[model samples]
Target: MTILFDQCNENLAAGNAIKLFADYKVDVLIGPTTNIPALPVFILATYYNVPLITWGMTSSAVLDDSPRFPTAGILSVGSKRYTIYVQ
Candidate 1:
């Protein structure tokens, strides 16, 4: 397996994600590593049919939706866990 990294400003994540998919042609994608950036990247990954693995500070509950993000797997605690804790 091969891993490639791209460092993108949060605002540039979606566009950079396209480059990773269309240009680099990555099979599996890992991280925007934070919630805001990860949101758009998750949508794009679904469109491209690529599996996504998120880590670090990416704790959005939305990322855990299997129907919405069938190809995604989170390596950290999603916000849903926090919701359960709070309740």
Candidate 2:
């Protein structure tokens, strides 16, 4: 199991997560930025056929009805939920 992290979460959060995964013999990849298009991650995961997991709030701007990527198995955790209002 490998994990990917974005720049915003590179402090203690990243350290802890990496340690946890390492304990389980899982490799981790920390990206410089989280705003990269989900396509790359999706493609990489699809090519490798490995499961992907996210540990922070993804940009809600990209998660509307027409999401940028397929979120079938993607799991996200955050303190607050994003509210959408349609004009």
Candidate 3:
């Protein structure tokens, strides 16, 4: 398997992910880490028929929606559960 890395510049720039897909033609996408950036990238990965594995700070409940992100998987604890753990 080939691995490529690109920085999203800590922003919600789906353009970076687009460039990777268009230029490198990656089969799978691993994450933006943060919830905000991961959101769009996950959608893009699904559109491209690629799987997106999310980790780190990407704990948005929205990411848990299998219907929305069928090809995506979240490795981090979800926000709701994390909150419960914290409290």
Candidate 4:
């Protein structure tokens, strides 16, 4: 399966994930840049017809707001101490 990661800031983490996917013979695509917008992520997923996964706080907000995301997935990798207050 092909998976796309959104707004990946650090190369080290991204690279590690990519390597892992490669080991499993899965196709992986990182975001175009480290600061990709939510809109672009949606567009990319639509264009590629692949699932999108994101990490951290900002990504949580995007996933929560995007109800129509096609195969869009989010993996919350933040610490358990983090809490989100949505008003």
How do the residues 1-87 of candidate 4 rate in per-residue lDDT, one tens digit apiece?
544443354444445444434454434333333223544554445555556555444343344444566655555532322444321
lDDT of 1 by residue, 1-87 (tens): 444443545558888788888988998888878888888888999999999998998898888798999998899988898889889
> Top model by lDDT, which number?
1
Candidate 2 local lDDT, 1-87, one digit each (tens): 454444454353445444444455434333323424333543443344344454344443443222333331334522223442321
- Model 4, residue 75: distance off in Å is 1.5
lDDT of 2 at 27: 40
Deviation from native of the Cα of residue 23 in model 2, angstroms = 18
Residue-level lDDT tens digits of model 3 in 1-87: 444343545343487778777888887877878877788888888888888888888888887788888999888998867777899
The alpha-carbon deviation from the true structure for residue 86 of candidate 1, after best TM-score superposition, in angstroms, is 5.9
TM-score of 1: 0.83
Residues forming the 10-long window of minimal summed lDDT in candidate 3:
3-12
Task: Name the TM-score of candidate 4.
Answer: 0.38
Give candidate 1 regions above 4 Å deviation: 1-9, 85-87
Q: Which stretches of model 2 miss by more than 4 angstroms?
A: 1-33, 60-72, 77-87
Error of 3 at 65 (Å): 0.6
**True-vs-predicted CA distance for residue 72, candidate 3, Å:** 0.5
Query: Each candidate's lDDT (Cα)?
Result: 0.84, 0.39, 0.77, 0.45
